[model samples]
Target: MGEDHMERLIEGHKRFLAEVFPGRKSQFHLLAETQAPEWLFITCSDSRVLPDLILGTGPGDLFITRNAGNVVPLTSQDVDGCTATIEYAVEVLRVKHAILCGHSDCGAMKAALDRAGLDALPKARRWLQHVEAAFAHRQPVNSAEGESAELASLIRGNVVAQLWNLKAQPSVVRAVDEGRLTVHGWYYDILSGRIEEYDEELRKFVVLGE
Candidate 1:
């Protein structure tokens, strides 16, 4: 089964090289030279959250980083992949927009809500501590989510908590203060396939289109 999966991936690459790459050869060549993406997208590592597919973004359009729970640690001394990527994206890439996105049915949030499953996964157990702040930031549970309401609320709260952490990053602060960057928090509902943005002034999540 593993070999079959690998073969499928190889075949997919071959197809891209043969059928897709030629049409986009010029675009790829230019990207090969240099990339100047306008957006820095940070989101969960869930396989379902395909940034390119969900946003209609292609290569060179977004500088992206993903991790479980889409966390941005608030502790200033905490140095990890997420913070490093953020600093580089803000300072070097000079991305104008930094989007921190969280989604419904997230495993990280689930684990954070119930820690029994994480006992065996020490690293994950420790890492999810970053999402503990989600409890205080929990959004109103949407009745539409039915039994999943609590989990969904927590996930949205995580988005807000992480977004705050993102903003507090030294580089992010300077950039925002200088009017060089804008930060956004988003909650994506898998069932409805809609996105909600956290409104700073309103202190609530509003449908993205609204």
Candidate 2:
């Protein structure tokens, strides 16, 4: 099974080299040397959430960091991948915008909702503690979500929680205070194929582009 999956990935890479790479050879050449992405996209590791595909962005457009829950830990004492990536994107790369996106049916949020199988996964269990604040920030359940309404609310709440953590990063704080950075929270609904941006002024998630 593993070999079959590897073969499939190899075939995809071959197609990229044969078909896709040729048309964008110059783009690849410049990207190989250096990247000056303007957006810092922090999103979940869920395979369903493809930032480039949904946002119509390409390489060199976004500096991305992904984790199970799109978490940005607020610990100054501990050095973690997510926080370190944020520091680099803000202080070094000078990314102008940082977006924390959560998706519908996120496995991380589901696990946080129910600790049923968490005992078997120690590291994941510990990591999920960061999302505990989601319960407090839970948005009102939307009837349109049907059976998944409750879970969806929690997922959106997690986005808000993580967004706050992202803003609290020292580099991000400095950039924002200097008027060089703007942070946003987003919820991507897999079923609807749409994105909702959290409006700080309205304190609600509003549909993007509409």
**Candidate maximizing lDDT:** 1
Q: Mark the regions of model 2 whose C-alpha exceeds 4 Å error after superposition.
A: none
Whole-model lDDT per candidate: 0.92, 0.92
- Collision count for each candidate, in order: 0, 0
In candidate 2, position 55 carries an lDDT of: 94
* TM-score for candidate 2: 0.97
* For model 1, the run of ten residues with the poorest summed lDDT: 141-150
Candidate 1 displacement at residue 57 in angstroms: 1.1
Q: Candidate 2: lDDT of 114?
A: 92
Error of 1 at 173 (Å): 0.4
lDDT of model 2 at position 202: 89
Task: Score every model by TM-score.
Answer: 0.97, 0.97
Off by over 4 Å in 1: 76-78
lDDT of 1 by residue, 89-125 (tens): 9999999999999998999999999999999999999
